[model samples]
Target: MSLTDIINAVVSLKKDEVVENVISEINKGTQVDDILDKGLIESMDVVGAKFSSGELFVPEMLMAAKAMQAGLEVLKPHLSGDATAEKGTVLIGTVKGDLHDIGKNLVSMMVEGAGFNVIDLGVDVDVEQFVTQAQTQNADVVCLSALLTTTMPVMAKTVEAIKEAGLKVKTIIGGAPVTEAYAHQIGADGFSDNAPGAVELIRKLMAA
Candidate 1:
């Protein structure tokens, strides 16, 4: 089967088909990174565009992300260290005092689909945890998410702490209440309002 077939499977939300096709491609000696970037990652990029155009919604995006993750599971073992380093590492979480996760989960899946090695710290993550994990993981980017205005300040604190720690990782922030202006005011390296945009934001930050 062609890589487009796998991408179509993911976009159609056919998780098992994605896995089976991915394995088939691997057995046929297809390069792991090619399948990931051309099939899985590109599918999400399309899905994100559809979402932006009102052709798709949250539930549909979630299903597509799930399908991509299924394919990723089959390809994980074949991903060499050099392959991962090429995409860079990402450390992501909901800032302190926040329980929201839907946005964060979506970003995590899309970032992974975009070829990054993502370490998700889950919700209600403390500022110190962000710094500690970013350092421990040698992350190339640290992302914070918060849905509440109250928790927004924590994002700034986390960014400051990362800077204070003198880590070289770039910092990005996002969520329902977050904006590009807020990102700049808080000293974050980047901001995205959606999952697909999050992947793009991370790419730009890493490039910079």
Candidate 2:
């Protein structure tokens, strides 16, 4: 499939075709990060815009994320096994009391697609878990996600744990219930509204 076809299939959530095409590109020696950034991530950016504009809904975003993950599975082996290329490490997870995983999964996939080596701590993760993983992995960034209005406190607690440790790690927070204001109020280093933007925002955090 063409690169554009692969991108659209991901954005539109055309499942099987997206996976098949990403592999095709990989076999052709296309750079994995390019396929992700120029292709899959760009498509997700559109998906996010559609979500904001009401042209797409949660179900569509989930399906598109599924397609993105499929593509990532095909490209991951080639992208992350090198040493000279320092993409930085990030520890990520959904905070406790938030069982909603669709958003968490998309953020994980998009972060991997953005070229960082990510450690996913899974859903319902607690504050101690976030700090422990960040410490264990020497993570460059710590990301906490929450889907409910009530779980925002968990994000704050997670960041607090890292801050208390006196680590140099940057913290990022995101979810439907999260905003830049709330992120700042909670002392998060950055905030993003969607998966692609989250990935880009994390990149910016790491760069600084």
Candidate 3:
């Protein structure tokens, strides 16, 4: 399949078609990451913008993200074992005492779709876990999610742990209660209220 076709698949949120054709194209020697960036990732960049502008909503954005992941799975085998060439490494998770993962899951998919090697620590992740895993993976970014007002403090504690450990992982925090003002107050490197914004913020942080 052509790269444009892959892009269309992502744009249309066709998970099955994208994964199938992407694998077919990969077997023909097209560069996997190029297929990813030019096609799926680029499509998701559009999805993100559409979502922010109210042109799309949670369900549509979630489906597009799912389609992108399907394509990524096809390329993952080819992507493995080239650690030195990765775009960046990231550690992401939802904070402890919060069982909700919809937002966290979406952000994880978007981050992986952007070609970062993501280490997902899953839900109910403790602050220490964030610090430990970021250090362990030598992650360029640490993304925290908390869907409830009560759980949002987990983000701050997570940040503190990273600071206390003297880790240089650039922190990004978001969820229902998270705001750019709150983010800045806590000294977070970045804050995103949505998945695409998260991905965009990561790109900016990496570029900086």
Best by lDDT: 1
1 versus 2: better TM-score goes to: 2
Q: Write the per-residue lDDT of candidate 1 for residues 1-208, one digit (tens) a residue.
A: 9999998898888999999999999999998768877887788878888988999898998899888878877876665432344498999999889886766876787788678999999999998899999999999999899988999999989999999999999999998889999999989999988777888888888777
TM-score of each: 0.61, 0.63, 0.61
Give the least accurate 10-residue stretch of model 1, judged by summed lDDT: 77-86
Q: How close is candidate 2 to the true structure, as a TM-score?
A: 0.63
Error of 1 at 17 (Å): 21
Pairs with steric clashes in candidate 3: none
lDDT of 2 by residue, 1-208 (tens): 6678887888778889888888888888887767877777677778888998999999898888788777766765665332345599988888998876656766776677677888998889988888888888999998888978899999988888889999899999988779999999989899988776887788788777
CA RMSD of all predictions: 6.9, 5.5, 7.2
lDDT (Cα atoms) of all candidates against the true structure: 0.86, 0.81, 0.81
Number of the top-ranking candidate, with TM-score as the measure: 2
The runs of at least 3 residues in candidate 2 whose Cα sits more than 4 Å from the true structure, single-residue gaps closed, are 1-84
lDDT accuracy of residue 166 in candidate 1:
96
- Clash count in backbone of candidate 2: 0
Q: Model 3: per-residue lDDT, tens digit, 1-208?
A: 5888887787788899888779878888887657766776677778877887998898998888788877776665565232345689989898999875656766777677677898999999998888878888899999988877899888888898899899978999998778999899888998987676888899899999
lDDT score of model 2? 0.81
